[model samples]
Target: MTEPTRLGGFLRKSGAFLVVGGAAFVVDAVAFNLLAFGIDGHGPLYDMPLVAKVIAIVVATVVTYVGNRYWTFGTRALQRKFSRYVIFVALNIAAIGIQLGCLAFSRYVLGFEGILADNIAGTFIGQALATAFRFVTYDRWVFPDDHESSARTAIESA
Candidate 1:
């Protein structure tokens, strides 16, 4: 019997997703910092955190979504159902909440300190958690085109 291809494909997809996400995160973080400091010119508590965060999330999400859709899952998943992308967007909204909550908590309660530092630290922690959630949801629901189950069923029946 041939080995399952899903495992290999999943690993490759997830790895690419991670790499793209890393780049996106850096881009968003830098933009957030620049806007918060250069444009508004305020510290962490001066009422610019949310704005910066929103921008960061938007920028990063766009990159993450495109990369995941194209490189991770490939075009096959896209050809399946268009509504799936909508569902994926909804799930990302939840992830945004998680990311924001962590950032706020670390900044307010833990006194994470500094605009850049607080955002960086909080987002790192938050995004880590959120990414895990995204993986499961995407694997089971979002893409839903791995075709691993039927292959197993056929193998077993044979």
Candidate 2:
């Protein structure tokens, strides 16, 4: 068996990340639209778009964490579960800020508060920026590669 080249490994990791992110994005989009726009343009949090975004982000964060942990970066290492979760949440909060900023810009700065505008600004543009940020930060900090240590730790535990 041969190890993959650097670019190959990166492509593989990024492909998995994209798959996980796409699923999480769906979750976020559905939750946000439901809360902010509702069935017929009047959701429970229609007046509170930011709050709606926060709620949606929370839900989507959970999904992304699980997917990334168990699938995207699963084989790296499984150390410091609680601390990793904390870091993950913190990074996600920063991502949420990115999303909220986009939404706010559309609603306040640009004065385009329609559903289409909100989706384009927050769900699409904001998500793209945040996703890129997450991929970099998560790879560098949250899920550092420690394959040898992880295997040794597993053997020791067993």
Strongest candidate by lDDT: 2
Instruction: Put down candidate 1 lDDT per residue, 35-92, tens digits, no spaces.
Output: 6665566635246676677777888888887787777767443346778878988998
lDDT, candidate 2, 1-158, per-residue tens: 24567678788889999999999899999999999999999899988899999999899998888888788889786676677778888898999999999999999999998689989999999999999999999997788777766777999999
The alpha-carbon lDDT assigned to residue 25 of candidate 2 equals: 93
Candidate 1 regions with alpha-carbon error over 4 angstroms: 1-6, 39-46, 80-82, 146-158
TM-score of each: 0.77, 0.88
Among all candidates shown, the one with the greatest TM-score: 2
Candidate 1: residue pairs that collide: none
Q: Superposing all C-alpha atoms, what RMSD in Å does each candidate have to the true structure?
A: 3.6, 4.2
Q: For candidate 2, give the lDDT of residue 123.
A: 94
Give the Cα lDDT of each candidate. Answer: 0.73, 0.90
Error (Å) of candidate 2 at residue 118 is: 0.5
